[model samples]
Target: MPDVQIRPVTADDRSAWLPLWKAYLTFYKTELPDAVTDSTWKRFLDSNEPTNAALAWQNGKAVGLVHFIYHRSNWSINVSCYLQDLLVTPEQRGTGMGRKLIEHVYATAKKAGADKVHWLTHETNTTAIQLYERIAERPGFIQFRKPL
Candidate 1:
């Protein structure tokens, strides 16, 4: 484990958060327009939004990021937390940074009165699956999507 501090992102964190955000998208082989990125940043800073983000800092540098959203669930009365995005710098992977970021989300979600925290990752993300298995259960759900 590294001496890292994790906290909610603020208005001042855009510069530090953008690179990590881009790296995450690249890891997933996806890209979004600048407008979407700008809107996401704004959501993180907005108190009224259910979407939130955090950054992990070590030695005065941001090393990881996590984004989560709280939404109503049909099966539960309490909000369900979706751990949407999690990423650590390539050099920081396997140093417990990923787990720490997730644990941070777990704590945050729990504090926010969420019933459970869940997320999805590509089937080919074997490295992340290893870590995820250690921390969460696989519920045997397959996702299907259709573009409108």
Candidate 2:
């Protein structure tokens, strides 16, 4: 793994993050319209917005992105961080960049005084789930979704 430098999202990263974000959605077979992408960039880049954060950088021009948020949980006494998405260009996958991205999420959660950090994956996503098992225990919870 090359020395991957992780940093917070910046206003200038919008250009770099878009294609990577689209690729991430594609990787999961999720479709995100262009307008939603524009809104997302605006929200995260807005200094006053509290709902989003991201880590961005490149491995020799390949982008890596991790988007996360903190939320209140009724069962948890303290706030929790939810890792909404994590992506590394396929070229960066085996280079330990994914783990590093996850670790950055954990560290950010800790620094923010969150009691826990969690995320869900498709049951068939064994590769990511396997990596997750090492850094955090899997909490058995089946996710359900309905379009509004």
Candidate 3:
């Protein structure tokens, strides 16, 4: 209910962004090495990289974080944006912070000439699905993955 500002993550945001990143990984019951986290942070700072990160700020504190990547797609000539990670602090969940973060990515992708923005969530994330369904359409594509 407070004034929220969404902005691209910067080198200075590393400290504020890490906790949200960790919390996000924790929510998914996953863990990554510190080096991987460091590499991801660096990628966001690299202009040449397709990866990017943004944060939702309320009164100078980051309440949420979103990570998106752009890549070539066979379905369209324009690049497609993949929203890889979205995390809102437990206290901030359902407060529209997540929506704001997602919309920010959508706008960013559009400005970059991307044709579509897509993402996946755990099937059990019903609360998040409720919001996502209202904003976007599901194409009923079941993901099949094999981790090497």
Clashing pairs in 2: none
* lDDT: worst 10-residue window of model 2: 53-62
Candidate 2: stretches off by over 4 Å: 56-62
As for model 2, its CA RMSD to the true structure in angstroms is 1.7
Q: Model 1, which residues run further than 4 Å from truth?
A: none
TM-score, cand. 1: 0.98
Point to the candidate with the largest lDDT: 1
Whichever of 2 and 3 has more TM-score, that candidate is: 3
TM-score of each: 0.98, 0.90, 0.98
**Candidate 1 lDDT by residue in tens digits, 82-145:** 9999999988999999999999999999999999999999999999999999999999999999
lDDT of each: 0.96, 0.80, 0.95
**lDDT for residue 111 in candidate 1, whole number 0-100:** 94
lDDT of 2 by residue, 22-141 (tens): 898888898977798888888887767655656546554645888887888898888899898888887777678889888888898899889998987777888887888888987677
Worst 10-residue lDDT window, candidate 3: 93-102
Q: Which digits, one per residue and each the tens of the lDDT, describe model 3 over residues 51-111?
A: 9999999999999999999999998999999999999998999888888889999999999
